[model samples]
Target: MDIQYVDTYELTRAGQEVHGQAPIDQFERLIEDLPEQADTMVSWTVKGEMDSFGQRFLRVHVKAAPMLECQRCMKPFEWPVDSHNRLEVVNSEAALNVDDAADADPDDAIIERILGSQRLDVLALVEDEIILSLPYVPKHDVCTLLSEPLEEEPDGDLARPSPFAVLGQLKKD
Candidate 1:
């Protein structure tokens, strides 16, 4: 879903209304399709306002379900993702670049881009949040039903060596 600058401006003036589900395919950059899992559904509401810098700012609250694979068991899992993001729309590229350089935190990179753009792409923002929030390695806890049971060693005793241990002693003679 391409968000146009004009649409954002209109939203700021007349209060934008957001609802319904957004297809995971809309965020092709952030995620790829897998054979085992289904697409994600994102639902959100975005409220826009003018910030102190006279830039348009939007606050988005999103809820989604992302399908992922469990790193340990290689099983598929559906995880719930909910997050809130704040975005600022700037009027010029130079100001956006300046804001990015001044912002020290790596987490704020998306915000900087939004601030630089004349248009606010809410779908892109949601995609960024989803990718950032995903775990590097997904695993189920020990208590989970999917967890594998540990194997026990036989006889509960350590094995001993043979009597031929003395054969090395005779070799020197």
Candidate 2:
């Protein structure tokens, strides 16, 4: 689908929906945030409608794998993202202020301040949701062995003892 920008008013008013699967390269911001190069695809489904509160909303579900640097190993790891997000379309500055007041933490729900245009950036929305779905610190459950251990080698070299071990030896003496 050619999801450059969508007409929000018409989409919400008519209660329309859009769905597609696209490569992760399509998401520029998401790619920039990753530490290593990624090769993955993101699938999304966006539905536009007015809720019972008479508020325009876009419900979205996105699935993808983002490449992230492991905190422990500093190696690139792929993290699968499958998340759902809801955004309330706020039409004006006044509407946005009211919505902002209603929820101090915008993360309570995403608010889209339409800033003089009915055009909604579908790519950004999908990107933001995927970013939010990711962990603050991405790491592998078990890292691969990438280097030699801290223990002394079998060639008769003495290993550096721990500070606590030296202190204990002093106490024994």
Best by lDDT: 2
Clashing pairs in 2: none
RMSD of each: 19.4, 15.2
Error of 1 at 134 (Å): 1.5
Q: What is the TM-score of each candidate against the true structure?
A: 0.60, 0.70
lDDT of each: 0.59, 0.71
How many residue pairs clash in each candidate at the backbone level?
Answer: 1, 0
Writing each residue's lDDT as its tens digit, candidate 1 over 67-159 gives: 667776666766656677776666666666674546556766656335433455667767777777777776644424554575564764336
Task: Give the distance in Å from residue 168's predicted Cα in candidate 1 to where it truly belongs.
Answer: 73
In candidate 2, position 64 carries an lDDT of 78
The sequence of per-residue lDDT tens digits that candidate 2 reaches over residues 91-130 is 7878765645565565664455443246777778788888
Determine the C-alpha RMSD for candidate 1 after optimal superposition of all C-alphas: 19.4
Give me the runs in candidate 1 sitting further than 4 Å from their true place.
Answer: 1-6, 33-35, 99-121, 141-173
